[model samples]
Target: MTSNDIRFDCQHRGDGGPLVIVPRIDGTPLTELVDGFEIAAGMQPAGDAYGGLIPEFFRFGPMQDHFLGRSTNTMGPKTPVLGCECGEWGCWPLMARITATADFVTWDAFEQPHRKARDYVAFGPFQFDRHQYDDALQALSAEIGSNVDDTRA
Candidate 1:
């Protein structure tokens, strides 16, 4: 199914196991997303466990730069390390999922929880263009295919 067909504003929730993408509309089965949705690390989906996934939201890439430059209302003044790929759980976008609700809260830097907290729960609204995500997915698929071909050669 196309991105438009899927309800984009659903929340990602998990009960200590695999995440379930629930639609805002009641009575909808979360399983609907089985084939329709793809979990993205940022703007791109993660590769298989056998191969390490690449971070696509870095400020270095042209598209990522454009995406990072376009700040959403939720995100306040750009932090010094907004888009750094420091290998730490640095920037948000832990896992990007579209929601059907537009009324959701935006980004707030002050909300980042520390490990010392008794309980930590953090979720951010990922603001990204669907077309851009599709393009990035295609590019990643091509790159993986190219690698396979080189290995065979």
Candidate 2:
């Protein structure tokens, strides 16, 4: 595929649960998502557990999205630090690029002078904008429709 061509795959649970999107891409491995429903502890019986949105991890690595798995509530403040309770790969400097590209995410910065090394600066956990997410999914769906037509031609 060319640089403009992007392909996506969707996987569904046999039990009729949330669907997962697999974006096959080659890059810096910047972001990954984890919906609130995926968490076993805080899962609600009804509605989208993550407010119909998927939270993204700014950093990249194996299972980085699951770094907050131990926490019952993954919606809390996210500290972009390496080897924290949340996850292993922590990159505070990526905030600029993340916000610039992701219009749906809003950054909330704070201070923590007590911590060692990465003191005095930390941003809140990234949250997904419901409207933007839905819109994005719709766009992807439309792309899939067009792809089907292209193949028939």
Candidate 3:
């Protein structure tokens, strides 16, 4: 796959729990890429924080709009692209500026919320075709949504 090509996969925790929606760019998991960058930079990678967001938080709605560059969270124009392994996004988050246009969507300016000194300037400015990116999001969201067991009374 090209550098711009992005794919979404569900990562089962093998504990009979919820599934996480992981993003793979050019066949490399995003968490690995970030951790590799940290290692190359002589910094300790935040292993516990290197994980994809829970499917519930990644469903198509405000989260999708955030990724599409249509909305922003408390981080201003940046949004949390990944969260902690414990499933608490606010505990540890990898934020990035997502820019979308009619033709393309780009993610850049990555920052670890708890590490202000860490420079992620060399990490990414990964761009993807808008059509493909949107399609991937919708498909993943649908899959997760369908499998959700909402037992609220």
lDDT of 1 by residue, 1-153 (tens): 112211212111223221112222123332222112323313132222111112232232332222233323223333211211222224322222222223331222312222223111232233323554445435544554554455469
Q: On TM-score, who's better, 1 or 2?
A: 1
- TM-score result, candidate 1: 0.27
C-alpha lDDT of candidate 1 relative to the true structure: 0.27
Those runs of model 2 whose alpha carbons end farther than 4 Å from true positions after fitting are: 1-126
lDDT per residue as tens, model 2, 73-111: 322344221221222123111111113133353323422
Scanning candidate 3 in windows of ten residues, the lowest lDDT window is 144-153
Residue 139 in model 1: lDDT:
54
TM value for model 2: 0.23
Rank by TM-score, highest first: 3, 1, 2
Q: Best TM-score goes to which candidate? A: 3
Error of model 1, residue 101, in angstroms = 11
Q: List the residue pairs that clash in candidate 2.
A: 78-125
Clashes of each: 7, 1, 0
Compute the lDDT of residue 142 as modeled in candidate 2: 63
